[model samples]
Target: MSSHQSPFTHPNDSSYGSLQTPDDSEQAVVSEEDQEPGPENADTDSTFGGSLLGCDTDTLASYITDYKYENGRQYHSYRDGEYWGPNDEHANELQDLAHHMYLMTLEGRLHHAPIVNPHNILDVGTGTGIWAIEMADAYPSAYVVGTDLSPTQPLFVPPNCAFEIEDCNMEWTYPKNHFDLIHIRELFGCVVDWDDFFQQAFTHTKPGGYVEILEHAVTPVSDDDTVDANHFFTKWGETVIGLGEKFGKSFTIWEESKARMEQAGFVDVVEKRYKWPMNGWPSPQHRTHGDDGGKSWKRLRELGVWNQLRLYDGVEGFMIRLLTTVGGWSYEAAQLFLAEMRINLKDFNTHAYLGVTVVYGRKPGLSRTASTETSSTETGSTKTDSSGFTVHPMPKSNFPGSYRGMT
Candidate 1:
């Protein structure tokens, strides 16, 4: 099929359209002339003003008295899936590539089955319901639940797996004493109050429960080789962080989350990290390109190009203001920038520390607690075998990716 052909029409993905939420769910109208003062906009009810996150006016008004979405380049609305989910416009090959990379470098952590079977499990911020669904399939005896703010989950679910649409920001309302394993992955924008959220998770969990959080460690990289500070992609990380803060979320949530879990009195905390390529090329020479890595790059292009337009249309004000008031950049100019984003998504040369980290804390068992009745450490606790996969500790150097050959 031609690249332009609609993949939605394909027999396997006929429900893609129905599954995706339409942009029509809510639309923002930005007018420079009628702009309200920031203090007034934020001081009182902000029903008239708009939020960058997808919550409607009533929802925003109920929480923040007055909040504007502007943080960095992108504004509030851009975070919504409709605004940024343009990944479909790119070649489907990239989509497959991303999934493949996920299966590879990303999926290894999931391969290690728990030495002990968990009766109840929670997959926090589960995307596409893939991991949760698979886990359900693996431990059919376990009750698996996946939760997200957006109601984008498929209607169908395995008998053991259930998906719920609820904000992780709100305090967890599960029974006071429940849940054996709580697993969260790639919840970059989904978790706002990591401290409060995890505290609640700890409380509801059974003694001997397990909590796993997987996240990406994002810090800027610098090399003797001068790269453009203004390189849009390089600074794009801030956009990801900015949008998250607007929604009361944390992109780099590991440190505080650990302290919170420990404060909740959980024992046996362990953190493991891994690095993966963002693009197909491993080095300047491309000497060792994993077949799957090549495919992952194609998916990178598609996922990226769609994100550009989303930032423009999704943001609450920044994009609208730049185009309307400044007149410095035209719509055509914006499209060109987006085109550049697509091109750079596959660029791999300078090393980037695109590493994945998993932090786990185990809920202590009642019998074990009684047996110890003293120290809080798990030194005497039974240690399970590491998830039968290649594991690496945190990178000593900042640039962990192998893209840079000279290094």
Candidate 2:
């Protein structure tokens, strides 16, 4: 790639790189289910036949036609005027960088679900298809399918992995009781109906399967009260929540994901919350011990830098759309307002952080006792038989005082 090449000049894994400014002629095409034919049709004809799906050009266009452009970036117009995020190449690359940064925070793994040997996986809102690709690599036997409104995934992927253009708000096309693991991430502003979505997810999930939701609380919190009532970040969060309410979506849905999953008939629902520092502020609690037995100041600083960078590059795209489309602010006014927000983002002394939550639930099947006993025996428990070697037993399941570890 050239020094001035776009972050998406080539198809690759989710990793960090500087995003180069695109020229006037360069743009990413958004795919909607009901777009009228135009010049993009001709462009699609020449650009999509050799894609990973290996379908004809017209067939590919059929999958990705409805779209609108803003700030020289393409966005999905599927469901006609819904979906708040962009589907452009720059946005895709930024999303991939965020994904990679999140993997670093999670030790390069996807989720905390205790699923084993899952044979069928579904990745909802699979931006860049990086998670699906990594999952396919981790489980070669699993058939991984990533679905999104935009067809922005790479053309080449693992044999077991595939990408589909589908609006999750609409009816799912996959067969019922099919997927062994259903993973959803970072869909705060996209999904309109949580009940309908989870009901469909429950119906599609196989018995004993798991559905995991990973999302970050967009509000930034400060420890020493540096982020006050007048802060732009705080106001930004308030505006997002208010906008979500007006649009019939909830930006704070992750906070109640466990209860929602349980309402959808999932069992053993567990929620884990993690924190990511917005910047390096020398906070001992947020600091990590180095591998060489010293304070990992450099690592912490890098994480802070990446976190701030991801936010700086990301906020404008979504914020502009929100302010203009929903808030009814002019583009110039939105940018003028966001300028202060960007300055606040660069303030390292604030010691701010974002709360990330990972919620996992199992489709109801066996009783908790049976499931625990089966897991305990499979994991080599202390129970033994008369033989010299350690034996496995279906020990009588003992209920615990608290359902902490059992879930």
Name the weakest run of 10 consecutive residues (lDDT summed) in model 2.
1-10
Cα-based lDDT at residue 239, candidate 2? 85
Per-residue lDDT tens digits for candidate 1, residues 16-64, read 2222322874735757667676854543334533332322433532332
Write down the TM-score for model 2.
Answer: 0.73
Model 2 misplaced stretches (Cα beyond 4 Å): 1-66, 285-301, 366-407
Residue-level lDDT for 206 in candidate 1: 79
Deviation in Å, model 2, residue 73 alpha carbon? 2.3
- What local distance difference test score does each model get? 0.48, 0.70
Model 1 lDDT-worst window of ten: 1-10
Can you give the lDDT of residue 366 in candidate 1? 53
Q: For model 2, which pairs clash?
A: 32-66
Q: Using TM-score as the measure, which candidate wins?
A: 2
